[model samples]
Target: MRKIERSRMMPIALYRYNLALPLAPFQWNMSQNHDFIQSAQRTISLERDSVDALLPRIGADFTLACELLLNCKGRVVVVGMGKSGHIGRKIAATLASTGTPSFFVHPAEASHGDMGMITKDDLVLALSNSGSTAEIVTLLPLIKRLGITLVSMTGNPESPLAKAAAVNLDASVEHEACSLNLAPTSSTTVSLVLGDALAIALLEARGFTAEDFAFSHPGGALGRRLLLKVENVMHVGEELPQVSPGTSLSGALLEMTRKGLGMTIILGDDGRLAGVFTDGDLRRTLDKGLDVRQVTIDQVMTVHGKTVRPDMLAAEALKIMDDHKINVLVVVDGNDRPVGVLHVHDLTRAGVI
Candidate 1:
């Protein structure tokens, strides 16, 4: 037998012989994988084109729908069936988070007494690519009978659902991305993108600010940074490292060590902030051959150190420390009296850094 080098061997022989399995139906092949990839890319391209086609369709009717939802005194009730219902739930969430009050109600559920959720003040935003989903259409009469304002998003303008709506915004697409042209691929993408467009437009029009967004997302990092104040995270009372200007350098060092803040606030005779003595300042004093026992903190302290107000936001405090290349800040009152101490570690612990 002759020895064959691994690098010179052909994978075809291995695949044809050693890799062959007893289960014929579960055999691995490359040709089917290539075809699958090609089909997926073609579907994606078709869907992208479908979304592009929707851009030019935004006009008077789109404006009317937005105006209806914006001026609506009550919530915007999103209703749909099947695949459209899945998109409806996401749309409702986006609308609610971005300043508009909205929620989803399945058409089937609505038919089963969930119709009571809809009121005259509520705006019914219905979705159906076919424009005539049976369950959704079943609710149209009752929606109108309740005197609720209806806005229908459908591919066909002449759809019964569209005709019943006070405003019909066309979400039509050129074709389905599915190879068989049967699945709701491109059509659903168009609907979702249109829903996003509506949500952002309303968000901008309502003058929604970051603070308002923070109120709704209090548990998120952005909310913590924006809503948390200096007073909420600062070290107060005994936790604050402080020393009078006349205190010995050793006493100041003890205060810094006790509080574990690496610095101590130096107060003047009037009990207002006179300066700050930090580890860096101590190093310089030691380099100059100053005796720690004989020196007072005022002799080595840096005057007018960076400070923040107790009411200032923790985010602002972080920015101040970052810009100054420092790790700590003293929270002072209007009279320049030290009230609290904020360190980089505090900001990190509070999830603001």
Candidate 2:
């Protein structure tokens, strides 16, 4: 056998193997967690800066855009391409909810038959960051031919889309949050903020009310709070917990348990609201070593219980509960007689919480 030097032979083989192989990506000397955090911070900072840049540009063009939409006989027909299209949809939704009738149509889809959605009475609000997006540009002539007012939001004011628009709302941003400065990061955020600004400005100009907003968002929690009346959430009929002042504390407890409200409204002999007896009163009474069977509810009940009207908003009832740090409210009519009993649980269950 030939005398073999294993270490020298292995070194030659290893050097040749290393020369043929590429470096592993995971072996790169960098902290991934640190990079992630740094990237997040940089993106947020860039986007925030872009949003700040929009504040100063709320000028005459913005006013003209508002005016055109406000005067339009038909809905606002919003058009955009790509990322601009996504932001346009949200803008339309916000406008629609805030009392200004609006809807979005994709520029590409508009070219392919969706253009019929736009009419002479409609006001077209087009979004194109570059102001030269071919799809949106193609619809400009059709929009103008139909005598529809065109409002353009873009970073490039000198571009064709801006030049063609009746009003150009400049949405130019300093830079993008993307490391390559090409992705729609800061620009999209600025566009969204500007759209919200427009919606809110028009909302205020039209004197939009919470009740109006509630009507638009009927299935939402805000609607339940604004539209659901006190009577709607209050326990009425036999579900209401009521007792006479002459009733014993033990009797009130039975009423509370029976009604599942943790409290009972106390009525005077005249049938008016005399007071309220609650589980908290039971605790205090117990702490005082009072006999539940011996004491009348009038002795242990809370005098001048918080009350609400049947017509009051459940939100108002919630506010009263929060202000008083109490969980129950007695609904009374003009005669001061208990019409219903409202519990915090009822408000919670009704989605008014």
Candidate 3:
């Protein structure tokens, strides 16, 4: 009887221990997930505060930095080390695309032989959060010797690099977003925002237009949209499907079939645009029991359909088509005479879509 009671009590104690063990691990997992979320939120909040801190700092020095870059006769050569180098490369590319000629040169490589890339006509833009990166500092004497203009973006305004620069744009941050307050987080964000501000200021000062930006990025979709004209992607000469307004619907269909444009332009005896017949029009005409052979195009054609100027941007022409739910447009001259036919496919082929 005594052994039976002891065995029963042992099982109850074992069960209780098993239940307690799971609770500990479950609780620990919940705490870990909470910590991860809290860490991320805290980091973002800190970085946001750091960027906000830069607003008051962007007064006289910011204007001076923009002025120097705007008046620069040659390219702006950017240099930095480590994470700052990565940000510098992006800033340089942005400046280059936005009307300012700029490029990045790694400080360590510049110390070796890449220094020759810099000339007296170029302005050197140095980036250093501490304002004392050895690799960048080592090149300052050489930059000065060449009589190159120096612009420094540094957290320490009184540091050697900043003191030597023609203008120092302060990029100081109170603390990093890292829990240990060591890794660069807030400082780099401030630097990138400041760099963008400088580039845009210069772009506005230079009166940079979309066409000028297109020229810089000719291989991109935006460039194609901005640079392509209706004339460049319109069906001209024999490719244009045209018929007299008095022509039979069957004859207009043949013209559309021959041109393969899914539409035909109806011109008057004086060669002025009178109407247009499309596949949609054919469907409507057939729905009305109109005879294709007996019906005149003028009876079923849409009069004075959407038209675009030959010199208008292909992108603008696309907007008209989208707005009007059209698949094609007639390219017209000053006299309202159809000179070319623009199909949606043409814009696609030209990469303007």
Candidate 4:
């Protein structure tokens, strides 16, 4: 028993010594923290300067490049190597989605059987920081043989690729954001920004609108907001909860409950929209000590409440609801007849919310 107690105490003493060890090496000092922040800020500043330098280079060459792309009958074929390849893929995707047909073809793979993807009608956009990538330079002959138009984005304007291209947009940077000044940091950022500028320019030139963009991104929320109309999601025909203006408030409540839309439309004798009786109106009536069984719906109903046209975008209807602090809207025809009812819950279910 004495030996066991001594062994346990020995382990406990070792554990306490280990726990007491200083963690200062792992903790950042004020000077080290300042260095970290300065490193990030320096990278941002260098990249910003690189992009600013590109502004002056956007001259006749830039205009010619856009013209080539705008007039191309076939898709824009983008080619690049290394980091430029990644940027090329992104640029191609942006162009394709913005009404410019484009796709990325790896320079190395193009020399393989993938060169078949290029056609005489297509315009080739090549990216290389050094502008002399062996794979790209080797394909220049074949590109020319195909009679395809070539545009190049490169740092060295005098390099083989740039000299071969119909127009070269300079993407040079004085220094890289990397501490060693060797990584493709600033250069890649300039290329990306230049690509975005090209895409936006082409978009505006082609008169691309939000509706056109929605067609390209049909799976996203923006597409739903822009493409879906009021008639598409509204409750119409028999699903519409409505009663005559002479309906008792209690009868209107029954209709609202049966329709499960939290509101009921009150039509006039001429069968047009006279007013709307909603849950809020019921609350206001009760607050005034009015009897639901005795009061008529027209006495409490809101006259000519917010209405939307069947052709209006659901997003517009959502805005009206938000501005008025209401949750429902009545869809009406030109004659002010209630044709359908729209509830906020319906919009939420349709993902317009």
* Clashing residue pair totals per candidate (backbone < 3 A): 0, 0, 0, 0
* Winner on lDDT (1 vs 3): 3
- Please give the CA lDDT of all the candidate structures: 0.90, 0.89, 0.91, 0.93
Which runs of model 4 end up more than 4 angstroms from their true locations? 1-34
Worst 10 residues of 4 by lDDT: 1-10
Return the TM-score for candidate 4, rounded to 2 decimals: 0.88
* RMSD (CA, Å), each prediction: 9.1, 7.9, 9.8, 8.6
User: Model 1, range 309-341, lDDT digits (tens) per residue?
Assistant: 999999999999999998889889999989998
Model 1, C-alpha of 342: deviation from truth (Å):
0.7
| Residue-by-residue lDDT tens digits, candidate 4, 152-240 | 99999999999999999999999999999998999999999999999999999999999999999988999999999999999998899
lDDT of 2 by residue, 1-353 (tens): 23444455465554454453445668666665567877899999999988887888888888988898889899998888889999999999999999999999988999999998888888999999999999998887888788888999999999999999999999888899998999998888988998998999999999999999999999998888789999887889998888887888888899889989888888888989999988888999999999988999899988968899999999998999999999888999999999998889888889987
Error of 3 at 52 (Å): 0.5
The CA lDDT at 16 in model 2 is 50
Clashes of 2: 0
* Alpha carbon deviation, residue 310, candidate 2 (Å): 1.5
Per-residue lDDT of 303 in model 1: 94
RMSD of 2: 7.9
Candidate 3: give the clashing pairs. Answer: none
